[model samples]
Target: MILQSLVRLYDELSRQGKVAREGWGTAKVSHRLVLDEAGNLTGIVSARKKVLRGKKEKEIPSDMMVPLMVIRTTGVKANFLCDNSGYFLGVDKKGKPERTKECFEAARVLHHQILDGCHGAEAKAILSYFDRWHVDTARECPLIQENLEDILDGSNFLIQVGNRDATEIPEIRKAWDDYFKSAGEEGNEERGQCLITGKKDEPIAILHPKIKGVQGAQSSGANLVSFNKDKISFCSYGYDGEQGKNAPVSKEAANAYGTALNFLLADRTHAKVMGDTTVVYWSEHAKTVCQDCFLGMMGDDSGLTDKELDDILIHMKNGQSADVSGVTVSPDEPFYILGLAPNGARISVRFFLRNTFGTFIKNIAAHEERLKIVHPPWEKDWIPLWSVVKATANPHSKDSASSPLLAGSLLKAVFLDGRYPEALFQNILRRIFSDHDEPAGGGKPEMFKVSYVKAAMIKAYLLKNCGTKWEGKIQMAVNENCNDISYVLGRLFSVLENIQQSANPDINSTIKDRYFNSACATPAAVFPVLWKLANAHLGKLDQPRAVYFKKKLGLLMDKIAMPDRGTPLPHRLTLDEQGAFVLGYYQETQARYAGKKEDK
Candidate 1:
């Protein structure tokens, strides 16, 4: 199903001239080998330019449309019109003279075979250069000697004639395309029914193109689909050790799907890396609006403005079509999202989800609604997906990464509107317990310990997955009128901490740093001690302020009614109760400082 969707996308992109044709693809060229009429090496001009990557500026190769390249592992394989210096100039930094000599010879033979009878100046100059160049004396050329270091860095090169690129010549393009069409006819290739296209007697691709840009995958690339026939379990009956034949995808279908995936991987607007997973998404009808809107919603850098995205989301919530960046996108258009993760030499499919674009938008909006909480003015109105997952990470850790598996699962749940993974909830709680005393900075007393994102996540999980126990109980802000036992205790803890902070204005540490975790887990034991401290703190306050605080404490304690067991506080709280305690504490703490300016 994934291949079928990608192939279909490739066809759509092809018709729109967004991707390469069947017999061609784009490659990164770092330099152009300038050649004269006599095929003499004249100059080596850089095909790369400096681009800003984060805070650093680095040189990146320019993308050029070139003939389709073959999948080469260690064995020698030469590409036409584009290749590293090893094949083009017969020299490299690897220091293997014999291997470099073989590379040059292979390129020479392949170019000669394709351009043998062509009379075009581009083709003739290319052939003449190959016949005249010598691997042993390549360094003798002043141009090659000057640029040897850069060329040997494995940067690709393209041939440039007087006013045009050699690859752009009509005759050479036709010759190369013709060669590509018939190259599969060579007897060495295995023929079978294509699993992707279902065409019989077609040449199957022994090796599919490499998928790049996936985090932690091979620097060169990794295979999304591959079969190891050496392992008997991977090979079917009668297939023997014919690797690709076991699942037979025709060379054309393989290239098509690969082209589509590579196109998405290369473009930022179509892909995003969350943790170790790289997510690529596309729309069925080839609309840029869908891509832009989706990326904007996921908090990726997109072309849409905040207002534009908000309007689109509002339309989606109303079940109406939206004009995104001046393009009207129907809600019924199919949208596909693919999650790819690195697994050694192969790419693992974390998820492949297909749904109406509107459905996805609605699911995202619903996720936002469920996570609604009273946030500080500094926080954005809508929390991004990355921020939600990042809440699970320990802020003090050097590598701020959550579980990769949990990241993927959390995204899938949000898109499908399913129950969030249990790990997400547990990890958030774990982070809260470990980071109990950490402050959100800016000298705000309410910003300590539990963050807004973590509190929101806990609230969302409990409301949706924890049944009717918490139904109609949780709210975006403090619920002053109502009281659950765990909640009242949590609110009381915040008031006690506030009293301590008020009494000792210069104190850096409060009871939260010492007793928050214990108070949350076993409120009965800690709250009594906190109450004794609160009384001493009250004595330090003025008469009016003391009376006000006492009244406030009495009101909250009155709400915690005693049951038949005659105990105001339970011995210990369960996991769900602990979450509610955190929520109550967060809400009440925010309430204490509501509408107040922070101390400068």
Candidate 2:
């Protein structure tokens, strides 16, 4: 029987394209077969190698042609007959033929049993069973035909059952049927009483099915069903009005729709759908209803439409910005809401205000959970130089000014002279002096000069505060006249005297003579008196020295004839033609001091 099976397998392989045209050599057959004594085959096997001198040459040693015939026979016997026929199919121990009638009879009996049991089973189930049996038989067999080995390696088939054309399984179809049946029954139970008018002979049911399957099952119309308990029954389909029976929305429905729209607009996480009625579609992962949708259902339309909602939702799905403009009362204000899709983009509803009453076009910033109820007004004002200076010193200040250092320099110039770059000075002055009570004419210049003088006085006071240490430098310089300190002090005092003589007309010539003679004749004589006065003031320096300097300087100023108190100092001095007077005096005093030092 084994020999017969082997011969049948060889013929089957030749019929198939799996085997080479030239028969396998003796060596190949030997590799595939192992046998027992008494000329009875006991095992089969397969191997492959390069055919050194064949038409089909160079290839992977394992790429042997499949033994299709041998595989089919083995599969049939093991899978259908349920018996081991692989042991009796090849060369014997002594390389002779092995055959037996008894073995064939046993295989025939097993085949009959399988055929009877498996005849009516589904082809898929039968194939599955056969596949299992084939695998078991192959593993148990000690040796297999070369083609059989190839066939086993090549076959990796799967089987499917039932009608291939069916769109849904039986279970799903049954579920749909059950759901629709239950829905229908519920609709019938909730049906309202028929409305009867006086002119009508018989009452008519307000809502009746218009057409069965008029719209396909997948369409919105087919998916809709309505029920009512009131005398005036209402019916409509398509939640968004894209499809289904068209019906006018009653006041109640409108309110409901408006409420839904508000809720959808308010929801931060759910992309809003605005239509006649707002809707928030739920996803598997995002199961919560949108707060905006809930608010909309409660009747709020902050200026949104169903189409806009749909557009925003579409954008949300695509991971794009879903901001829609012109929906709210203030069009410039943005209304931020959540994106519907899993994409983390936000949907914004914007309102543009038309012809607002303020100088600036107002824009209110809003988002989900936070709405700007009142928009603050914007005002324009100049920023002070001091503010700029302070801001520059503090790194934490976020001032919008471009260059704080430049601002500070400009401010300092104005503080020192009250006449800096006109534009910057005026701007900073306006900010600082806006609240001052001083008049704007001559009073303004006077006030500005006073401010400048006050700054200088503060510097002098600070130096005086240095006490004996500060006086020692001046005393030493005066005694030794080191580095021409005597000449410098004489020059400075002469400049002050000249200014006083020009400004005041009541000065005594004797006092002027004494000041000049002491300042220039012997710088030491001027230094002792000036030093004693400065030290005395420094000893009592807790008092306001700035005020003291202003008062004392005013008392000493010569009374020069002037038009009014408000006249600018520059204008007065120019009118008097004292341009070179102070400078000439300073030069002469320095020259006198220098000559006297040379003589000493």
lDDT of 1 by residue, 1-600 (tens): 999899999999987879987888788999998888888888899999899999999999998888988899889999998898999998788889999999999999999999998998778889999999999999888887787778777478998876578877989889998898897577877888988888899888988889998888998999998877565786876776777877889989999999899999998667888777789999987798898889887766788888988898888877789876568888888999999999999999999999999999889888888899998888876777888788898766899888989989999999999988899999988988888564446654443478888999998898877848987788888888657888878888888988999899999899988999999999988888999999999999999989989998999989987778755788899988999999989998888777355632
Displacement of residue 580 (Cα, Å) in model 2 is 54
Residue 494, model 2: Cα distance from true site in angstroms: 47
62-144: candidate 2 lDDT, tens digit per residue: 32232112234422232121122332222122222223233333333433343333332332232333323332244344444
Model 2 weakest lDDT span, ten residues long: 357-366
Segments in model 2 whose C-alpha atoms lie over 4 Å from true places? 1-175, 178-188, 192-600
Each prediction's total of clashing residue pairs, residues at least 3 apart in sequence or on different chains, is: 0, 47
Q: Indicate the residue-level lDDT of 558 in model 2.
A: 27
TM-score of each: 0.76, 0.14
Q: In model 2, what lDDT does residue 54 have?
A: 70
lDDT for model 2, please.
0.29
Best by TM-score: 1
